[model samples]
Target: MKILFFDTKTYDKESFNKQLEHYPEIEIEYLKADLAPRTAPLAKGYDAVCGFVSSDVGSETMDALREAGIKLILMRCAGYNNVDLEKAEEYGIKVMRVPGYSPEAVAEHAMALALTANRRIHKAYVKVRENDFSLSGLMGFNFYEKTAGIVGTGKIGAAMAKICRGFGMKVIAYDVHRNPELDFAEYVSLDELLSRSDLISLHCPLMDSTYHLINRDTIAKMKDGVILVNTSRGGLVKTADLIEGIRARKFFGVGLDVYEEETNNVFEDRSDEILEHSTTARLLSFPNVMITSHQGFFTQEALAAISGTTLDNAVAFQKGIQNGNEVSA
Candidate 1:
């Protein structure tokens, strides 16, 4: 089976090349261009196409892929909100993804973001580099006994709950389907979690019902000086409302590894270019707010797992074996 890998970065190529030797049946041609309508045509001679989180795999791109005789889409990452699953189904394109690459990798990043944002480490790092060692604005509260709210109880969320418990924090979670093994977390309602949590970390998926879960009304419900961190889907929080919350001093510190406007800037160095009407630019202008390029699942372990599983998925599809990674609309 031949695959057209799209939106590939240096790390992607490096990791995938290491795994390619294991799967001699699968062959991949890497391309820097993202999988969009225009680039989908390049997959005409390939069996399947691989894309990252930032690839545009909507109806138009699916149309082009269908015309190109492509039948499978392999998402190396866990999240598939960027792909139009309904359109892919209509086009007879089977979509598969690595559901859980390395839960500990993402959970560790979430903990790092929460702690860094709460303690103003990002700012302190810059000040100390300039030989200005001052503790004027670096004052932060202790997390030993604080309440931590986790939005989802999946593998990653469960890992986060374990980490929070290790910090001597009270872990509370709100999920539609609760995990019985997540005994450390006290299950609660969303409103109660929002109101009671001193540190809130989002770990939920992005769906129509979960889109904009953190908005103006939800932010108003959170406690004052609460630290907000998101390492999950970007669409879960409303960016404009988050800016408003920051302006109103609702959050003590905000750390986001994902945001609504990240697609345009993901893995790209736009440092020299001036963005016009960019929400990401607005988000970056604030000192208390921090954002990463959706790299929560970027650990070496996660990358190796993703590369192995993606090729396994392609091999399974070639043999008409349903390995349960198939995603449906």
Candidate 2:
């Protein structure tokens, strides 16, 4: 099977190439070009086209994919919000993804971001490096005995709950289906999670019900001076409302690995360029706000797992075997 890999990054090439040696039936040609309507035609004569979270496989792209004779769409990442699944079905293309590469990797990053934000470690690191060791603004409370609210209780959220428990924190979670394994986490309503938690971390998927889940009304329901961290989908929190909340001092510290306005900016360097129109730029101006370029799943273990699972998904498709990774509209 010949696969056209779009938006190929240095790390992706390294990891996938290493895994490719084990799969003699699979042939992948890496390209820096992203998957879009214009670029969809580039997949001609290929059995499948692989893309990441940044790839746009909308209606026009799906039409072009059909014209190119591509039958399969492989998302190397977990999230498929960028893909039009209904259009994929309409065009008779099967879509598959690596659902859980390394839940521990993302869970660990969430805790790192939460700790960095709440303790003002980012500020202290900068000050200490410049020989300005005054602890005037570095005051922070301990996480011990604090109430931590985790939004989702999937593998990742369950890992987060375990970590919070390790920190001697009281864990409360809000999810449609509670994991019985996370017995340490007290199942609660969303409103109660907001009002009760001292630190809140989002780990839920982005859907119609979950989109903009943390807007003005939700923020108003949260405890004052709550430390919030989101390592999941960016659309879950409304950016404008978050900005307003920050201005009103609603959050003690905010750590984000994802944001809605990060579409054009994620995994790219714009260091010398001006970002006058970017909400991310506005977010960077806040002292308590810390943002990373959606890299919560950047660990070596995650990369290898993603490479293996993606190839396994391809193999499943090639052999007419239905894998759990197959997603539908």
Candidate 3:
């Protein structure tokens, strides 16, 4: 079977090639452009089309893929929020994704952001670089005796829970679907999680129900001077609510690896241009805010594993095997 891989990056090509070595019979075609309305026709003559998180796989793209005779939409990443799974199902295209590639990679990054924000490490490092060893405005408290609430108990949340435990923190979690493995964590209600946790980390996927899961009401319910960390989908937290919370000092420190309106903004060239988006600019104005461009899954190990697993799932689906990760919408 032939597979057309869209939005091919340097790392994607390297990792995909290494993984495809296990399936020599499958033919691969690489396309560097994102899967959009115009680029969807490029999947012609291929049985399947594979893409990443940034690619648009909505109704228009799905129709174009159907026209191109592509039967499968394979995502090399865990989050399928960018893909219109309902449209894919309408087009009779099966969707597959690589879930749980490296939860530790993302969980560890979330912890790094939390620590950096809470401890004011960014400010101190810059000061030290200028030969100024002053310690004002860098007073950070100990993580010990702190209460940490993880919003999702998936693989990443479980990993973060263990890390918080290692810091001598009491960990509580809230998830619609509970994991049997995370027995140490008490599965509390969302309100209880908000009111008690000193540090709250988000690791849930973005869906209709989960969109803006952390909003004004939730922020109002949270502990005062709380630390917020997000390494999950951008839409999970409402940007306006976050800004209001920060402005009121309800959030002591905000660490974000993703933003609500990050598309066409994050991981792109903007050094020579004036900054757009007043919310983002205002976010940067705060001393306790730390923002990263959605890079929690950028680790070498995670990328490699994601490519391999996605390719394997796609190949298995084509060979009439049941892929556990296949989604029907």
Name the TM-score of candidate 3.
Answer: 0.96
RMSD (CA, Å), candidate 3 to true, equals 1.4
How high is the CA lDDT of each candidate model? 0.93, 0.94, 0.88
Clashes of each: 0, 0, 0
**Higher-ranked by TM-score: 2 or 3:** 2
List the RMSD of every prediction in angstroms. 0.9, 0.8, 1.4
**Top lDDT model:** 2
lDDT of 1 by residue, 241-263 (tens): 99999999999999999998888
**What TM-score does each of the candidates earn?**
0.98, 0.99, 0.96
Ranking by TM-score: 2, 1, 3
What's the true lDDT of residue 225 in model 1?
Answer: 95
Sort by lDDT, top down from the best: 2, 1, 3
Q: Tens-digit lDDT track for model 3 on 161-256?
A: 999998999999999999898777889999999999999999888888899999999999999989999999888898998999998989889999
Q: Model 2 over residues 231-326: C-alpha lDDT tens digits?
A: 999999999999999999999999999999888887888998988788998998998988999999999999999999999999999999998999
Worst 10 residues of 1 by lDDT: 281-290
Q: Is candidate 1 or candidate 2 better by TM-score?
A: 2
